[model samples]
Target: MKKLIPIFILCVLSCQSIDTPEEPETVLEEELMIDILTDIAFIRAAKTSSRKVFDEKGINPESYILRKYGVDSIVFAENNAWYGGQLERYKEMFTVVKSNIEVSKIKFEKLKKEEDSIKKVQDSIKKATGDKKDDKKDKKNKKNKKEELEIDDAKNRAIEEEMEKARVKRFNNLSGKE
Candidate 1:
């Protein structure tokens, strides 16, 4: 009976401790420190990358760079000395830049292939139609329009999926309690 009484009192005290709220001032101070540390790290990264122009730009460059890179802003900020904003922007920019590069490469390849196809078509029209100018022009125009539409469709699909993934990740991160 005595042991039970002591155990009950301990449990009550433990429960009381668990219900206590964290001091607001302490949390604020910690958050401020984290912000400062993140800013410092961002500065360092910018300096290293010779992107120090970002500092002068008055925008959080690190978040921009991190976002462009397609990295999580929070993770990048937490790991680096930069704030969340710059890292987030950085990640986004990185993704856009990379995608643009890839798109350009694809466009270049398609253009090259299109040029070859046009040449072949021109030669065939001349040989088969005995130089029917209007027929060649119509066929070339149709081919160009079709290729443009296909490229536009492909680019739209890629961009939509990329944006969707980013949106989902953002939603998940925000919904988390931690």
Candidate 2:
């Protein structure tokens, strides 16, 4: 019985050791939270700047602000953080800013394409409808004008649809739904 008791105690200790799981290495949640907060703050600042430029100056604010501050200067300042924690925070903010610029560039490209298409349509319509009119020429001109008007109307509808799609896409991307 004494030998059996020693064997049972040994088995129990072995089972306990075998079944115990190792704890995962600690991650600093606070640091992660702070980085996320910094990124959010940077995005908010960019949105505010964009609104200010659009509302007050009738222009996109990003290039204006970048020019005002000097991109190189801002980059240099961000790179030279005095403390390690601050360096991480600055890096996070920089990433956010870069992402914002990338999204803005995509939107600008879409707008430019739409603008070019509208201009081309407008020029064609002008040329078609601006011809000199007299008798036979006047009848032909009226028919051409009607066709031009229909084309213009179609172009306007297309532009409006594209603009709406772009607006929805932008909103979705900004809201993190995309």
Point to the candidate with the largest lDDT: 1
lDDT of 2 by residue, 147-177 (tens): 9999999999999999999999999999998
Question: Best by TM-score, which number?
Answer: 2
Judged by whole-model lDDT over C-alpha atoms, candidate 2 comes out at 0.62
Per-residue accuracy of model 1 over 45-153 as CA lDDT, tens digit each: 5576865565576676655655555556555444333322356744654455456556767998999999999999998887888656678898999999999999999
Which 10-residue window of candidate 1 scores lowest in summed lDDT? 20-29
Model 1 lDDT vs. the true structure? 0.63
Clashes of each: 30, 0
lDDT of each: 0.63, 0.62
Each prediction's RMSD over C-alphas, in Å, is 36.4, 31.7
Error of 2 at 161 (Å): 72
